[model samples]
Target: MLNRHIKSHSQYKKHMCTFCGKGFNDTFDLKRHTRTHTGVRPYKCEICSKAFTQRCSLEAHLRKIHGAALHFAYKQRRDKLYICEECGYATHSQEVLHLHLQDNHPSSTFLRKASKKMEMTLQKKQGEDQTENSTADEGSR
Candidate 1:
């Protein structure tokens, strides 16, 4: 409604894009528009690790890209609270939750260590096999 009204009248454009000379009446509108030229992403999705310049864009990504069932926080305020799926720990910060998952979650931490061990074992076996092959070739010569 505001955009329509602004467009109908030659609105005094206060906000201007740095990259382009395009003018916007609202500062928020100008910032959101400027992201297109700057390729700046300030907001990021915790689930998929996708980034977006605008908060609305990130919210839209959660709905359309992630196919998440949208729920209003008014009705489900407790659900809005970030809780660990692995443990019962709760935190508002996403970075804290990510650290908690990596440090405290048994599956993630253990699996990472186990995977590294397995990779090292495989590499050692390959090195031994190569050495044996080289020794055999030298002996035959």
Candidate 2:
């Protein structure tokens, strides 16, 4: 990752935007940048049914507009999903999505740097389990 960051400082941009001639060191950035020109809003809010170009935008809309709380316990990792922008292929496993990108869309700019993992959000199932356990303990006491 450090090597990739160092390479980003160089004059070379491996991924170039077809729309505006913008250059990016990582293909992931280029893929995200292309969404601006393509107007492809892949991330959709489940509550309001509104769409967004980025996942963070959707999350912010959920928090701000829909009053959704995104609190997570310490050291808890959230459920992750990797969706293909080109084909709408969604997967819970990052490795599966990576393999799909490599095999299906080799020419596309969705391939990110090796060893870089996307930040995950918390899952509701674990919280529910904790609640259930606490209730059981209180009943036993």
Q: Show model 1 residue runs off by greater than 4 Å.
A: 1-9, 73-141
TM-score of each: 0.43, 0.54
Local accuracy by lDDT, each model: 0.66, 0.76
Give the number of the best model, judged by lDDT. Answer: 2
Per-residue lDDT over 1-141 for candidate 1, one digit per residue giving the tens place of the 0 to 100 score = 677567636667876776789998776577567667756665668998887766567778999988987776754443233334333455676455656667777576434643565568779999999999999999999
Can you list the residue pairs that collide in candidate 2?
78-121
Which residue pairs does candidate 1 place in steric collision? none
State the displacement of the C-alpha of residue 75, model 2, in Å, after optimal TM-score superposition: 8.4
After superposition, candidate 2 runs with Cα above 4 Å error = 1-8, 73-77, 87-89, 93-141
TM-score of 2: 0.54
